[model samples]
Target: MMSSCAHPLHGKSVETQHKTAATTSQQEKALADIAAETQTTQPAPVAQNPLLDGLPASDIAGVQADAKRIYSNHWGPVSERSRYVRARILPILKDMGAPRQLEVVPVAESGYNPYAFSPVGATGLWQVMPGTARMLGMNAAKGYDPRRHVEESTRGGVQYLQEMYAMFGNWPTAFAAYHRGPGNMTRRLAQHPWKPQDGLDTMPVPPVTMTYVRGILGLSALVQRGLWTFPEPWETHQVSIEGPIDVNQLAEAAQIDPEELYRFNPGLNHSQYLDSQIVLHVPESMLQPLLANAGQAAPEYVHAKVRKGDNLSVIARRYHTSVHDLKRINPDLSTLLQPGQTLLVPAGHMDSTSPPLNPLLAQGRRIHYRVRNGDNLWNIAKRFGTTPAAIARANSIKSDKTLHPGDRLWLLARARTS
Candidate 1:
């Protein structure tokens, strides 16, 4: 919980556990293992770190001391959650052309806990109010709040920060304006203006606002300084569609968990939908498959030649498009057809691949072979990169189906789910 901000949580207490020798060793080894396994190198620091944004945080006596104390105590336990938070935001900040330093703003706002909610109606890592989220281009309706999505919320937060900076002409003031509404700041300035020599915290703003800005700036410093060991960047890639897409189908074809997909694309409506376009970030390995599936699943179509005996109904079914859509895309398709003529049509499932059948599905590959001596399902599965259950299912046999030397069986390959 934040020491001060939208909600003070002043009476709330945080829990911490001391690490035993065994757990400490485990943590060190885990860190080393992660370092070895990570594919991403450290990102080069830009001339201007967004984390600093060259802003002076509150120098009030409590600010510095409280920030340090908060950092030591709040982060005393498992660092995995902290790593997850950093991993999600770094890519977003880079993509937005915002400072990587700006990432800790979410942590300051809500500990980068997307599900964190406040009675004040603030929600998500950025702790944006529903009204503010909507105003800043985030969909927060129907319990499908995109603000809860890490990337989407980062985009919204970045946009808001940019607006604040553009208006205030300085990062400190921009940060102040973000925590306290611009109108409130303006009104406060009108009532009691301070000379340029006087720092901002001296102004007639609430102490909470000052603490908010200070926390964000101080937390950003802690993260950058290696005092907090943020995780390595995630190994992932993203695709930007020209328009909004059916992310569910795209997730299914890619074989990724749908919830994970939503986590990467929180800009979509939280509930049913509110109609808008957004990007899709997926694991680096699944990028190509997702793109290929998206292309095939897209409403767009390809051309197919009509074979002999292909009537309108037959052609419509051949392509996965409706007969009405066929007529619309290809005018007079319902009225006329030639055996060898090409026509526009939605992509068929077979057309999803460059060739309708891979070499594995060719007639030569389909030819059944009799079970050989010493052959087992494991060996067959290894040979074909398919599961034994898939092979048994094809022949309508039990998973434990035993094979004898004269038994004929068909081999069907299966794609591995990511």
Candidate 2:
């Protein structure tokens, strides 16, 4: 039967009661490990200067007003939602080499509510469109949108942000592109190119897009400056299941309430049984019991050395597995693969007939490039068909900063104009 459990994070949500068991020594150790990994620390200090440059006094006042409104009226729901997912989402953003400040994008997008659905077909914590989800290598098939899956959707959202950053060459423009369509942003920028000195206020984009960018920046600043706070993150660990398993049976085996299991796994809500390999996030204390009762043999893992031209997609395809599975097993995997780095993949014979790489992903492959004399973000972006903002973001440098010869940068193979 489909789980009728209401999400605990949502308003008036039904609470799922689970039986409490005494903490065994092994489970206690596991919980400690999870705490060390997932607990939130005091955030790094925020820069005293405003996030965006060249804003007039009017724009500055507007942003402060927005931030105040969010802090006063929306903190309850936003903080509750953010606390649930912040621990998990932060690592994904870090893996993508995105600025830690971007973690608040979901807070601005959907208040970090995974089930949040917009009238225009945007869904999930990131409010990603179905078409955009597919472009990011998600399964957006009928009755099964991985966009609702917290981990999968976060990866897709970050990928989209990275793509937009590549196209526009800066966070404000990228945020605008994410809100409006990239095509529209491109046309608008062509008519009025972004000048660093002029700031985001000068952009001829839609008011809503401008508001969206401002909101994200404002919210980020509040949290960083200790004016706002999120509750402690719920400690959980992602466990991979290799094949179909009935929900009731699986929950019983793990000694968790069915409703609780359903609450943690919204992407599996469409069916009673998970018919394919998938990742499940379980409470940290339940990790050992779940593994003990799994009934199946331990999963085999194979280590693969990173190659010069390799990416998660290429490695996953070769192993006949999905990138999600690869990431679940290797929690520390970065979006940019470095030669000689090792990764753990689910054991499978190499598939010579592996399907072609997704076209969208093929265009997004990254390569390490050494900076040469006279090379700058603009020239490098032009050569790679990306933007100066994109090069700067990937390399964690200011777009207008001078590049020194022998410095290294990671460049996307080719950014899609669309």
Candidate 3:
């Protein structure tokens, strides 16, 4: 019965074939101390996978055809991040009993920009932006990059999809809400603007957003029937982490490269996962030591367990440190820590005051921009297609209006691009 319950998607979707022992619930949540593990028997989410999960085969067939057309039209450059997203989501879909056809949604959604932002500002490989990331408790700094952590992002994305499903009671409606947000979808529905409240019928939405929801269903169907192939082949894995640590640290501990970690955990960014809890991903045998260490404490780094009412200043003071020092070592410190959480304190480093590193430094280039006489920060920024604050940050200019002609400014587009 347990195996049958787990194989609920058999004969229905390709996602069933993707599930493996690595992503079983027993391993995915194995990060906590032994005592915190639970043995509750919960049904897999296949029945409630999405609104479209219950659609008639005929309807799904139609969606599959439409999705292929749309995806083919908008295909763009394949980004490493997109590849990473595929790697993370495929395993999750299988684990949760989602159909394999679901893979098409990412392919269509990948065209806009590597950092596609909806009007609501969801961002990254999965389009999860800062605001939504915060809502999901993802830290953007301290090198904890959840946006770069594929598993965390996939989990968050799935959770978000599930919430939308609950609200509209259908896959199509939920997809629209996911893009436009429930607030806007509700407003559109109240006005009776486009189609009906029924997502399948399509009452009204921006044409692009409407197409987006349909594409997700359609492409998902195509992938299901094997009518389309994911442009890239992504092998799947199930990984488990054991301790509170940053993604970089986990990469080190796992004996896997940081890029590999980024491939598996797209939700992490330097800030969002400074001292993140244990995360799971595709298991790599080489990372066994790191995986084991991730569940335990490490030396050469201070692991501060957050207590109630502990803010940055309090935490710093308790450790005979300064908030500036704390922020310095934890570059994304601003984003990662919460009360009752744990943080990784680097040895002997405190003070969050280091100048932001040139984002291009990681890629081995020093980006420079020349100041124009008529250019204020905003104008200079607009000319370069960046934010004024970014220009200011690059040049270390205190006054937005202050700039001297011929001053060379570092253009940090690489960071923004990432």
Candidate 4:
């Protein structure tokens, strides 16, 4: 059930109030459930030095205190869920060579929302967008949603941020580029260069990106001071798949929910997994068969010569498949195809046991809203005729009081019974 204050914005913006009126929006109700869970549960205290059992006493105590504080602060409102996501991402942070302190701040910056996006189109919990994600080999598709995969997304975020640092020669510039694409910052820095004394203050950036840096800094300070709490460490296992596979198919093969798969392997594209090896994360219970099947041969495709006016979408439609499937089966097909060039198209029911196809249509509809400057949760919620809590609930948001410009919030209908 929604909170008693759920219907607070009865007269808000009609255009944005589809959560109550649209029928096909299942994500809205799911987010509502998340909000309810956030309001009711109190998370257990996370161990501060997961790695401290063998450490010196002095180090153990300091690590423990830092862990506790970061855990607490990280769980501003939705402690349990926030902690869950933080725990999932902890290993990734460690793998990225992030200090314990740096790990906690990202949880704060993202509030555990894996799909967070910046105004300049950066996406994921780490806010990596399509272009950057592609460069890092993180594919975004229906069954293989890379944005939801903590390990891939976090690793890509680290790499992207490091690249930004190399470009601007400073953490602040790197972070600013994270919020407002590196291209924008590079242009600005070239036109209005800064002195050592000016620091980040002299850089020409949007107020929201500026505040994003501050937010990261604030989170880093709090976490460093041992002011937040973290979630319990959930065991992570690897699932390997071979050949042309789709994430949803792999999820079914493992007998786990697709959402769970996405949560762990957010770097996957939705439509299909190309004919290459991929290691996905899953609970320990579902790891065996996935690994065993990793050695199986990928489905072979027939070489079909391309004709004029042949696009992935059209070709996929002709073959009763999706553009994603086409892309996966034919990774060599560039955007511009030659008239006589051959492309590998999946033929027949080779993988009949796999999940139902048409993932493109299945995951088709989405609402994307651009974040405006000086916008807050209250204004956004009011604009949507939804409470701040509802908006927060929908987006895995912890605090219903803060926001950043260039941020994108996905809205769906909660009460539209279709």
lDDT of each: 0.53, 0.60, 0.49, 0.49
lDDT for model 1: 0.53
User: Poorest 10 consecutive residues of model 2 by lDDT?
Assistant: 1-10
Residues 1-418 of candidate 4: C-alpha lDDT, one tens digit per residue: 0000000000111110101211234534533443343343442212222211122223223333343444444455534544335666666555655435445435534556554433333344665445466667664333444544666566666666656655775555666776667778888888988522243345577766655554554344434333444446556666555656555555566566767655555445433545455666666766775665443424345445677888777667666678888888777778877665666666543332222322322342234556779777765544332356656776887755467788888643111000
TM-score of each: 0.46, 0.54, 0.49, 0.46
Model 3 spans > 4 angstroms off: 1-65, 73-87, 90-102, 111-121, 139-142, 193-202, 231-389, 392-418
Candidate 4 residues lying further than 4 Å off, grouped into runs, are 1-101, 104-110, 116-122, 136-148, 190-203, 241-258, 268-279, 285-348, 351-418
Looking at candidate 4, the ten consecutive residues that score lowest on lDDT are 1-10
TM-score for predicted model 1 compared with the true structure: 0.46
Q: lDDT per residue, candidate 1, 1-418, as tens digits? A: 1112532200111112212211245434643443343325442321133433322222322333556666556554323444444566776666665666676676667665554544333556676655575576664333244555666567777777767666655555667777877777677778887421254456566777766766766665445544455656455565755432345555677776666665444433321111334455566766887777764334344456778888888876766657888789887664567766777665433342121111111222232646768777766664443567767887898878788887877764321110
Count clashes in each candidate, considering only residues at least 3 apart in sequence or on different chains: 5, 1, 61, 31
In model 2, which regions exceed 4 Å deviation?
1-61, 139-144, 241-244, 248-259, 288-418
Q: Better model by TM-score, 1 or 3?
A: 3
Best by lDDT: 2
Residue-pair clash count for candidate 3: 61
Rate residue 354 of model 2 by lDDT: 18
Task: List per-candidate RMSD values in Å.
Answer: 21.2, 21.1, 16.1, 18.3
Residue 324 displacement in candidate 3 (angstroms): 26
